[model samples]
Target chain A: MFLFMKQHEFVPQVPYGTRDFLPREASQKRAVEGALAQLFANWGYDEVVTPTIEYLETMTVGVGNDLDQHMFKFFDKNNRILALRPDMTTPMARVAATRFKGSPSPMKLFYITNVFRYEQAQAGRQCEFYQAGVEIMGASEPAADAEVIALAVESMLKSGLQKFQIGLGQVDFINGIMEQSELSLVQRQQIKHAMVTRDLVGLGEILVKSGLSQSDQTLLKHIPLLHGREDMLKQAYSMVTNDKSRRALDNLANIYHLLENYGVSQYVDFDLGIIRDFEYYTGMVFEGYTPGLGFPICGGGRYDTMLNSFGMNCGATGFALGIERVLLALERQGIDGTQNCKGIYIGWNKENLVKAIKQADTLRDSGCSVELAVIPESCAQAKESQKSKGYEKLVYVE
Target chain B: MTSSDMDYLTIALPKGKLFAPSAEMLAKVGCTAEDLSENSRKLVITNEKEKLHFIITKTADLPTYIEYGAADIGIIGKDVLLEEEKDLYELLDLRFGLCRMMVAVPEALKREKLSDYAHMRVATKYPRIAESYFHSMGIQMEFIKLNGSIELAPMVGLAEIIVDLVETGRTLKANNLLEVATIQPVTARFIANRVSFKLKFDRINRITEELRTLLEGVVTL
Candidate 1:
């Protein structure tokens, strides 16, 4: 009983909100990531890998204190705080500002790596997750934003997703309204908090208490409902007379036109309420969604101000797709893209071990995944092994 | 699968006081089904013609259904939303099921202010909201989590204070509990899954607009 208790106490377990992807899940993740890497590369983006741990100051500088609670922070040797990166965008921006500072005019980069975030773990969301993303630095034009959005759509397609939409919005659209309004800072923050959570009811209550004119309150309340195609943009244009908001609307239109040229406008829509959770996003923002998933499968936007904090004063835009989310969406849609079948299972009789080894190597050389049996086996056993192990064929060496 | 199944919109309705009004509100938007009542034995009711699906759920679990996309939309109370804190789109205030979350103490305590007692035993069904409220006020207390009949806690000496929802103050009066502070007003809210709000924008938006118009008329009155 004492020995049993000791054994039970020593039983291994993974940390909470983390998972070990066994062979099948790992293969599916790899396949989807491989397709995304190829797609990003075809779009003229080079891949970059960054350290998983960074000084807490660097991450906070890029993201903000809002995500500080979510980071897995610990003290390093020198008592300096270190945190597992909660995202790749900040690290990518860090790389751009430091290593790739004088590389080129338009530095296009991509990364497929895991990030850590301490949060409630659920389907498609874990404390540690994988993301495949790309960034384009040194370009401030709408074309760059359009390229990123188009690539995001293609990334979804490449990951075996058939039906999805990108809800595109510009941050300045709301900033313009806030600037034009005479509300105090606290009231503005309350409105923004309500908007970020998509709490229209709370937004309505705040606006009513904000003492703004009835027209302004109505306009503010209608922002969350401002979602549709190009014609909705015209309606939004008529509602806001401020130059900042007008310029934002025009920027969205230009990006939309470019997306149309990319033949991806069919999968895009204007949702002026998409104030993404990231505070660093300066201009256009977007989130990708599929039918069966409750949360966004991918999201990103332009962050012209992030790199500037790192001392590189240039504009940049990028997007990231959740690998697990893509896999979950594919599963829910009954789409299977990962291949896990071995080519052959080779079994050997008493004197044919050498032959079986040679045959396995030959099959592997010809691009077949062959699994050779360790001990001697009969033909029937070899066939049974092949059937049970999901090998396509069986080779018995006698 | 039938074509209706392809575009079916699933709504999760809280099972208690909010059920009847939520069902009625959905009916006004052309989404109705049979036996969708608070006491009905049926858990799921479908309106095939309107391509609408409704699932009756416990008040606390309504947000969970919406958050996981098990149901596209849900009608839930703000008090439960505060405690559960699920990430969802709070689209509209249905304006029914009015109540307030209050911190109450027994009348015998004679302590009208919440800050009077620096340390006290508190009981609540909404531990998160209760803890956060106390923390915000710089109060220190031990919490005892109870599911129902929170009013009986203070009377039985299990706790000195209780945090609960007061719809009419009649229950508190019956239990000899006096309200010390009001946390926030509570109401039935219409919420939706983030992805569902975008993918089914047209249908959901139409229903929301219809409901908004109806509620606006009521407000004006």
Candidate 2:
């Protein structure tokens, strides 16, 4: 018998929650990452690399119980507890504080990396996923926030997404409202939860029970309805009583005005109820959504206080685009994925060997991906040879 | 791609008490609902004459169905919309099937501060909702996900607090629980698929306007 004997059962096993990227899938991913990288580079943000793993203690700062619970943790060779970074922003903060210490006042760095989380795999969400994002450090101005939002929209567009929206919210505004309320922490959380979920009734009840003035209660009820075009700012300012809350609203309005100036206003709308999931965010927070993807295609916020957790205090805002989700959106848009895969196939016959080798080498040197054909002559001439060989472009050398 | 002469408008109706009333509302807005009843074994109800279709789905999945273009318009709960955080238009409030999402615990546990249960087990179908709500409190609670009958969680020692939707406090009363807090008010809403809301503007707006009129207090309930 030949070396090729009976094929036993193909071990039907894959590492749970992780996946192998076949050629086409990988090419599609590369296309999305490449476009996003160029978009970030064009915006004068240099790329930075962070490790996939970090100390558990470092990654858990202000991440809260839910995300912290979802992180994958293990012990290192030195018996030190480590975690697969659940998000890039935290790691980026660590890097900025440690390595890039006192590098510059206004540092802008972009990153394309995979974050690991232990969550049930489903549509558009994976255990290990790739993200391409840009962080602008040392700037707390509305312009910096708008730049991040604009970059998010621009990057999504660069990846061929036309139908997407950015919902902007200032955490300070929402958190300010909560802070101003004379209620227990649980009540504040409950109200914030309701507001974010658009549960106006629960919000009303909470506000009513707190013994705040009717006007204050009414203002709180309008949080969910405080969404729409640029003109909504006037309405938002009218709701809050405190300067902090008003300032937060004004900050959002400034960001909106800046985006309008950037010609990207069409893609953004304000939602005061849109609170950031992370506790670190101290300013503007936003999420990018597309119809085709189940989760936000991108999410980022200003974490001015978080860097201080790493012993370096500077205001920063950034956003990360889910590369895999972008690729999926492009696919749904009917954008061709195979066009970039210029795969070539050549026969193994000796007479045609030199010619085939030369052509393959020349093509390879010219930046084309070509693989030598290893199919036997008899297999090539079989009844359904192409079905098994699966070559897209075939070259037969004389 | 060719612009087809025919256009099909799809609506995602949350699969609940609102489904039947929403189907009736859809009919008033010029769509057929002959089989929109929840008792019907149909997954998809279509009206070929009007080029309209309805996809009956889990009440919570209505937003996803609309956002992803699986359905063009969805009648979802304000609760689902609040929790999912998608970028869809809350075009109209159907104003039917109203309720409130509240924080409740065993009546005995009401005396304790909600923060007293910090890092303690809380059970709910809305983990994100519960987590975010608690996070905003500057306290954290561990979430134990349950589909239904969350009242059982407190009784069975699974969780200390139960976050759920309550209509009249009757369910909680029956379960020996008290409303420790309210999160938000809940109502059925008409959510539009972003692209469909734009591309099918005229037709969608017409239907939405009709439904809005009917939903308005102008009509006698």
Which parts of model 2 have CA positions greater than 4 angstroms off?
A1-10, A197-201, A337-343, A375-393, B1-10, B14-19, B25-43, B46-52, B58-221
Runs in model 1 lying further than 4 Å from the true structure? A1-10, B1-6, B38-42
DockQ (0 to 1) for model 1? 0.58
Measured against the native two-chain assembly using Cα atoms, what DockQ does each of the candidate structures obtain, in the order listed?
Answer: 0.58, 0.13
For model 1, state the Cα shift of residue A55 in Å: 0.4
- Count clashing residue pairs in model 2: 7
Measured with C-alpha atoms, the lDDT of residue B107 in candidate 1 is 84
In candidate 1, the residue pairs with backbone N, CA or C atoms under 3 Å apart (3 or more residues apart, or in different chains) clash, namely none
- Tens digit of lDDT per residue, candidate 2, span A1-398? 33555578454656668887897799788877888888889899899988888999999874756688889999999999999999989888888888889797788999998999897776567899898998888888989999999999999888887777888888788677767877688878787776554344456667778787787677777665566666677877776778889899889888888898999999887866666667778888898776545456788888898888888888989988888888876676666644653566655555666777888898889987776665434435532443355655666654
Residue pairs whose backbone atoms clash in candidate 2: A197-B82, A199-B184, A199-B185, A200-B185, A201-B185, A202-B184, A202-B185
CA lDDT of A135 in candidate 1? 93
RMSD of each: 2.3, 7.8
On lDDT, the leading prediction is 1
lDDT of model 1 at position A257 = 99
Task: Give the top-scoring candidate (TM-score).
Answer: 1
